[model samples]
Target: MTPIFPAKAGHSVRILQLCRAIKALGHELTFIHVASKLDTQKPDIASHVAFFGERHFLHLDNGPRQARFAFWLRGKLRRRWRKILRGFGHDHSHYSGLDENWRNPWSHQLRAMDRRFDTVVVEYAFNSRALDAFPASTRKLLDTHDAFADRHRPFVARGFRKGYWVSLTPQDENQGLRRADAVIAIQAQEAEHFREQLAQYEVSERNPEIAVVSHYIGLDQPLPDHGVDHAALYLGTNMLSNQISLRQFLEHVLPRVVSSIPDFRLRLAGSICNWAPDIPNVEKLGFVDDLRAAFARSPLSVNPTIAGTGINIKLLDAMGAGVPTISTVTGVRGLGGEFNNGLLVVADHDHAAFADHIIRLSKDAGLRRSLGLAAFADAQRWNERQLAALDHCLRGDALTDTAPGHVARWRDRTPPPFPTAT
Candidate 1:
């Protein structure tokens, strides 16, 4: 699947899990993307391009050109039968956007790919022009990492403005939800929201269909470091919520959090955008390449966000290492761990109340230790490796692979297309 985000911005864990799943299942898979060629230019190949595959396709020139030819030749997914039957089997399903730049034109290619495979796994509710692109027989799983429209449109940078797929209106994304065979929500609350919104928008569906799958990171080997322990801290990069959340914590949350504690410092780390505050105890660490050194020194990782969707794997990362942690209710969205057990406390939605909780946690080291111990204990219950298996088990097509036989045999089946009005 195409994941548009950079590897560093928390998408690596999920991608790695997917890679591991494919490997464990013994699937002879191949990844086609511009990254194959770009890896030669990367300084750190060991870290950046770690996934092993039968083929690392360099499609900077050919694939897109083929896709365009396919799009033109196929004229929507169903009509391009002969073109798709070549090279790849008719069973070859397509996924992810080639690039965010192609967000506008990706619908056709995805739709074409949709008809090609018996299952189409969509990561984003991108290009909606080809809404019903999935073949009637093909299983469609919408693995939602985040609520794009909610986070993007109302974010601090482009508040309420329209983005490219003016059609991906909450209305349109909700449409993809209705059309999808199943919906996979990363966080529990978002899974609930997916169900609620689907019904609210009257997308035809029964109940209990949206699957709540937590975002996972496979840590087969134990992490040697437990992270730094100190006062209060916030760390993230480029995300809109990180900008607003940190500001809210520094201005409204930290003072109350440190009211009882003396010399409490809140370190702000990661690549930041739109710097708007100057707090005394706050340390600004712009663009941290290796967070291990930083995590090794900090006491608590604080997340004070009220907006956005998906489980914060960042919070999981902190808890995984037995680091003292505190998060806003919205921040610890899908964690199965308990407060004072895995995480220290959930910041109350009210600013004063939230700060008060942080203040208490910051002042009490005994409390931090107790929480850190509990958090580590809870980490035992979260098996990232198992989560990958469960995700793969969701569909029948995902149940088979290696040789293209099952998919290759589909060359004779006719691909169904959606109505043009959409």
Candidate 2:
């Protein structure tokens, strides 16, 4: 169950992929979406689910009324309260109960369903409170897309004041994680983090089991004939990390590339275009209907992300489409450090060097073809791994803690030449 409206956010994409994976394992699947107040019932939602073939989709009229009301009320308090706190040069984080709306109606809905399924999979940790609604007979699984605490750490370290209403406490996060029967971690780093956290909570018996399921493009490989299209593409939802990355690219990298290539075109696609800055040589294509065709039109995908959590769906999608990707080391975090594939990694803050690599890839079709083919091959392998991992989780097998070895493998790889020696 996901606490979101239908959109192409990375988490939303994961929910859809998990649904398909569940069905592929020959299990009956039902998707219960907790509609946000901003989300009206989307007729296209049913059509979208139909694309996955057969699955039952249930959209609650809207999220729990009380929680939404509280969310609104607390939002007002945080806005006013923070100003007074800032006057003293102090930061006091308030935890709002409003954020987790799965208390009454959502819980009731699950109880009404009456443990009909073998397991209940909750998409985000914020929504884990809903796990309490399921019967003892039902296996509760939590998909920790990213460790919420780790996600907030970067923001807090820079003294960036978080929106208080949605602020999460370490205890609050651990409570939800500890309650789960099992956890599906998006990356190996997070899988290890979850294990260490579980030990801190000393959760025994019902201790949350951990499984690492990295993101993957479906089994379909890209056709080699699509050929390089001479443009750089960026795909993202309207999240803060994406906004910051896009802004950085525009400010630091795009100008340099434009000076050299003259007609260099950068296409920013998805809901992210809504907030991305206006800049020269960049076309903002908001919420594209055909992402594959978008990739076909732009052979080079750029991920300039400096801070974000979980496996980047855009990275996987571009590689899956056999488009060569150039990104900062932070952009490629959680993904294994394998530069032999079609991925180019640059240092976090190198603007000129990043531009040079962009120029190199843009000009060399053969290099693009080689890297793209390698990426496609890597994606195919990941598809199999994701499916097998999902199958093990569903079959109730004990998941080995793969994080230590996974992290070791990544650390063991000789660091790729940042801004490849051009």
Candidate 3:
């Protein structure tokens, strides 16, 4: 169950891919979407049908009318106060008043269903309370996209404003984890953190087992040997972290590259184009329908992200498309460093080095092809590893053999060291 409908965002893509993976394993899936109070857009029924099949989906207007009214009123007041504070030269960007105790009123409906489910998976820890509706015989799983306990501290430390999302105290987060039979974390680091939190709190007798399951992307066929155009690609949404990093790249890095290679262009796609500044040689192709064709057109991609949690899905997508990419250390977090031949990692805010790498990669076609091949190969192995781990979790088996650092031992295959770009 999820509050978010599948869309173009990373989290949404994870949801879509996960359902597809589950179905591939020959398990019947019933998708249930609990309406989010913040979203007003109607659910895309067609997309849901395409994934879960006809009549296998449920949309619940779960919250009570009184609670909804209170939430709406609070939102209005918060917006008004923000506007007023902005006028006073105060920054209220980090303040997000989220209610962690919000529960679904329609959970009782789950009890009335004629069929009994063997396993019930809830998307976020905040919604793990829904597991209460399922019988004790049903195995409960919580797919935590990111850790919520003190989630805002990282953004604040990096000088970025916090966005709207649930930020729970460790104690509250522990309560949610205790409800699940197994907790699925998006990355290894987060899995360790969850284990630590649960150990520290000692909430319940049911010590939920934690497992690491990264994002999954279908590998794209290798690009043809005709060679790519002399342009780079950047795809992202208008999330605050993207906004900060992209703006910094534009201000600090783009100019250096333009000076070095005057005709070189940077292609921007997706909702991120909405906030990106107008600049020379920066082409804004907003909301491109064909992402594969877009990646095919460019020889290289850039993930200049400096802050955020979880695996970077866009980075994985670029690797899946067999495109060489340059990313910051934070952008490549939780991914296997040994298999990063197609990726160039830079320190955060190191604009000069970032620009230099772009220039060098643009001038070297043979190097680009070498990295792209490595990327494609790594993507295949990574997908297999993630699928295997997910299969184990779904089967209620202990992941002792497939633990974080031990994943490289899968199939007894050793990963080669990343090829240097010099």
TM-score of every candidate relative to the true structure:
0.65, 0.84, 0.87
Q: Kindly list the per-residue Cα lDDT of model 1 for residues 305-354, writing each as its tens digit.
A: 67655677677666655666767777776664333365645544677766
Q: Which stretches of candidate 2 lie over 4 Å from their true place?
A: 1-6, 37-45, 48-55, 61-90, 150-153, 156-159, 162-165, 201-206, 226-229, 338-340, 398-422
Tens-digit per-residue lDDT, 1-422, candidate 2: 44223546676666666766676667787777775442233445656566543446665553467866776786677768767876676534334342344535666677677337788888777888778877778888888777765354566575655521144565667777877887889887888888887777645565678888766464455646545555789999877777777888899899899889888899989888888777678898888766777877788889999877777889988877777899898888877855227798899899988999999998887788888888887776566557666766766764444343232112222212111000
Off by over 4 Å in 3: 1-6, 38-41, 63-103, 157-161, 202-204, 403-422
Q: List the residue pairs that clash in candidate 2.
A: none
lDDT of 1 at 202: 55
lDDT of each: 0.51, 0.70, 0.76
lDDT of 3 by residue, 308-365 (tens): 6788888988888788899998899988775697899999989999999999987788
lDDT, model 2, position 416: 21
**Poorest 10 consecutive residues by lDDT, candidate 2:** 413-422
| Candidate 2 overall lDDT versus native | 0.70
Model 2 lDDT, residue 1, Cα? 42
TM-score (C-alpha, index-matched) for candidate 3: 0.87
